[model samples]
Target: MQDCRILITRPEPENTLSRERLHALGLASVPLPMLNIAPIKGPQEQAAIRAQIFDIDQFDYVIFVSKNAARLACDWLDACWPMLPVGVHWIGIGQGTTQTLLEEGVPALSNPGHTTEALLAWLKPAKMTNQKILIVRGAGGRPELGDKLAERGAKVSYLSLYERQKPIYTAQTFFMLPDVHLIWVTSGESLTNLTDYAEQHKPEWKCLPILTPSERVTLQAKEMGWVNARCAQGADDNSLIKATELHIGKQND
Candidate 1:
């Protein structure tokens, strides 16, 4: 594992944590952020988020899609509602998001398994009809969550607090490609950006072993011609590390 050179494609700050964790595990990590998060700063966007926060109590379930969603939304909620409204059940997608919510003084129900399917399975017993659900996430994410909730007769509204954009690549971007043995792609967008960058600069590296957190991302990688795309058990640093270890073990075998 110490000899494994993994390329992390998460954005900065988040990438830093993953790198540190990988380093602690004796794996070398190269940060190659494929996506960048930018808060929506327009007056109209701010007004819309404020409007949603103003009616926070009306929502029956508040779902946070990621840690970023929880952190960004709560930043506004903390300012508007000093005392969070009671009885609004908070749902976090994973442990990280749940921990962020707790840090923001928002207690939430989180799926220990760390996936949308896991969260949905956990919420299946709840009465969803006539319930108003608010989803806090980055702009232009998958619609499956809201669509599925709506299918169960819940009125789902989205409060997009941030937008994801591809970062501009430089000469240093290509420098890491030679040593990258496995690429850790956290999102479908990141995978797409990585493949796009590879097609243009290092097409020969497209088939490099890749690790992903979801089956959806694994499928995306395969469609993009990645030969060894493996899905980890969950969307966490520990899960990714374990998956990488297993992949390396198989290669050794």
Candidate 2:
């Protein structure tokens, strides 16, 4: 456990939890949040979003892409509809998103792989012709889900609740990170931003072990010159921490 400091690139309160879990396992952690999440700005956009939320029951299905989307959707839906509509099918892309909905008193279904490809596979057999589907997520993300649903003849609508942006960094503070044996990142956007940072400021990180939540992100990291990138099962803290243990320990051995 000694000298096994992991640079956690997850955002906000989540990073705090990640650090706590790493410490519990006798591993050290350094928080370096790459994504800054904020509600979608502009009054017209807010009004339009509110109108959409008020009519949530009109959609045949609602798919949450991340925990942030789930939490925000729950809050909005709870305010308008005390009892969730029964006809709508709720889908979560990953276990974490599904768990968020469940904890919010709204049950959602998701496959084990926790990737968009996995969700699309499970959704392939469903009836989508002329159906209305709402995809809840941050401002900018992969259009694959919506595009696939459209290809199936489903009318898909995106309800973006927030925006994910890279944090403003004025300094090239590579030394601020601890002796990072492994880097834990959850999303492709975060991975891309962090990879850019490494290329510009911390070139050495390219050779160190890194864990990504999905194979797509792992591939992205590798393409960006991170030679030692590995994919974890899921983005949740426990899965990341467990994978971190193996990678960091294997390196030490």
Candidate 3:
């Protein structure tokens, strides 16, 4: 069967998961990556991470907001600290992040639901006060996680494990669009990057339907002029596939 052409807007190295999922749906995906993940520079960030390595025991909790954060933090932990310190509780924002922690031999506490809101609700009942939280994340994001934890009387310390950057577009990738039937956007950042690129090169590509991983992401796509954006009810492979099938099924009708 001739697979439906799909454009994946995630970054190159990290686009594998989405590519595999789209491939399983029998879609011919072109990895038109739009962002890259790189380490943040400067002595201040590195020095803080170095200090946090040994001060791990001081923190009452460690939270990983995303799988990438978990991976990057684990990389640093392996290099600096020989083993994950005990007595400090670990929390992941969602199932995927929790799985990453479990694989790394960390006993993590996380909500099965894949949302920051779910994670917060789960933690609220614990009533953990005066607990120091070490948050491993990227350059920055919504402050809700830390803010909520602080409201619960927790001291939150943020660590920048890596940085997400817009990918440099080339003529081969940028000008060769319009053939793709669908574009899958996993992050708002990726959507923004594609919208910017398309506007600069091929504005007509904005009419393509975008399948986003979350409602928050869907709104971003719409703001980018992909008015036909559809969101997965959940952020998982099953939900993504279901969302894609629904969208395609609608198109067929």
Candidate 1 local lDDT, 1-253, one digit each (tens) = 7778998998866899989998888889888899999999999889988998999899999999987898888899889998999989998987777888998889887876777877777677458888999999999988988888888888999999999999999656696555788889888888899898888877767778888878878898899899888898666787888899899998889
* Cand. 2 Cα-lDDT: 0.86
Error of 2 at 86 (Å): 1.5
The TM-score measured for candidate 2 stands at 0.94
* Alpha carbon lDDT at 175, candidate 3: 62
lDDT by residue (tens digit), candidate 2, 1-253: 7677788998876788778977887878888999988988799998888899888889999999998899888888888787988898898888878889999988788876788888887776458889999999998879999999899999999999999989977545675655677789999999889988887888898998889998898999889888988999789876787787777667678
Model 1 RMSD, rounded to 1 decimal: 1.7
How many backbone clashes are present in model 1? 0
Comparing 1 with 3 on lDDT, the higher-scoring candidate is 1
> Could you list the CA RMSD of all candidates, in the order they appear?
1.7, 1.6, 2.5
Instruction: Report lDDT (CA) for all predictions.
Output: 0.86, 0.86, 0.77
The candidate with the higher TM-score, 1 or 3, is 1
Backbone clashes, each candidate: 0, 0, 0
Model 1 stretches astray by more than 4 angstroms: 176-178
Which number leads on lDDT?
1
Model 3 scores a TM of 0.86
Per-residue lDDT of 187-220 in model 3, one digit per residue for the tens? 7777788888888887877887778876777887
